[model samples]
Target: MSEISILKDFQKRQMLFMELYKKAFPAVARYISRKGGNYEEAKDIFQDALVIYYEKLISKSFSPINNEKAYILGIAKHLWIRKLGSNVINDTIESAESEAVFAEEHLRTDKLIYLLETAGKKCMDILRAFYYEKASITEIAQQFGYSGTRSATVQKYKCIEKIRETVKEKSLAYEDFIE
Candidate 1:
């Protein structure tokens, strides 16, 4: 395939994953939460499920699943069980109990995320495009209206630096909270 065609295929897959994330992650996360798993675990399992789903979809002998949402959810559950066996009931229950101890810390993390979302959304968008969507510099430039690849690269670095500064500022408030 040509470079342009490869890029298009990647973008198409990114869109597919985005749609799947929107459709499937909330329910998966809720189930994880109810099972005493944290948000990070939920994210990990969901991402793994997407990888599996995407690979199957792209395989030469692909057999389409009937319901993608349910398919992804089932994959996520399987992965979660594999990662932490179903016998981890006590661990998960204890995790839920320990969450209350970290409630204050979670609030601080939430505040930092809020700042990132509100004050640095464009930067976050660029970073997300680069990291999460695996978008090429050229693609990111075109999408974000950057003049060129170099411009996009510069903007990406600047955004990373800006986010670092913002995170440092936020971290200062939690110096005591840290151990």
Candidate 2:
């Protein structure tokens, strides 16, 4: 299907979920409340369950094996248990947050991004399309009005080189950035 159709389907599903949310949330709240959990915690867990259910329903491999309400409730049960520190992989909420540990390269990447944005806009756009957005050479060529992929590839390399040079120059000018 086309992008518009996919988006429309998603919106339809979102609206459907609003109805499901009204139906499902009360049971989730009652379950949580019985366990001494607050309303906010119940809402958080139910939303995550809804997202999981939505992803599964939209996946290409999906089959109608179980009713949507029951499936979502099952997922919510697992999520609630995981929240309560019963699951090994998700013993605590902090454990999940800790998994996304920052890397040192991110700092250098930030500096490179700053230098690229300040240095040139067209080059920045092209490089972001190629690297950050992962656009194909043909797509990039078409977007930027290149003759073909070869020309786009060459321009991509030149942009990379320009950004690298700017990064080197900036690092040198600002001694704090060099090391």
Candidate 3:
């Protein structure tokens, strides 16, 4: 694709991502909380999933073979499972399912993190602030010295798209790690 077309496509995907994020976050938070995870854990899992999604998109390697919602939710589920597994929780059927999902999710999450770490300090800073710190666009703009919140928002979206592309290229899935 031409530069303009690629940029436009990316922008479109970013808008979709933000919308999906807004919609899925609450359900994800509730799921985690119900499973004995705290608010902080829910937030971390959600953010990690978004980071993975962003990495997949930015690398020009992601193709939407399935519903975006499922893809993102799968990532979140996997991350939550990993978090639970690392804790000394009792292993029940539900917990086992979570563990299974998490084992699958970890491989992708690990790769996504590796790619994000390689994306340099700026991408990491923006992702950390927006995803982990839960900072607003205005706050990030001020902190990053952007011209305005709009600029910061745009930059954040672009960074997320990059992450999504990176994840997609690998075609990692929950089934991959499940035996």
| Candidate 1 Cα deviation (angstroms), residue 80 | 0.6
- Per-residue lDDT of candidate 2, residues 1-179 (tens digit): 53234435634544466556645555555555555777678778877887787676667777753345545655776788888888643323332222212212222334534776764788877875664345799999998999999999998888888866876765634223222
Candidate 3 lDDT by residue in tens digits, 85-115? 6644344445434544443444344453576
Off by over 4 Å in 3: 1-14, 86-179
TM-score top scorer: 1
Candidate 2 local distance difference test against the native: 0.61
Candidate 1 clash pair list = none
The window of 10 residues in a row where model 3 has the poorest summed lDDT is 170-179
After TM-score superposition, what is the CA distance of residue 79 in candidate 2 from its true location, in Å?
0.4
Q: On residues 1-179, what C-alpha lDDT tens digit does candidate 1 reach at each position? A: 53234435756655666667656666566556666788778778888888787767666687756567667766776677777766333334334334433432333444545656654778877876776676899999999999999999999998877766776776644322223
TM-score of each candidate structure, all chains considered together: 0.54, 0.43, 0.44
Model 3: residue 41 alpha-carbon error in angstroms:
1.6
* Candidates sorted by TM-score, best first: 1, 3, 2
- Quick one: ranking by lDDT, best first? 1, 3, 2
lDDT of 1: 0.66
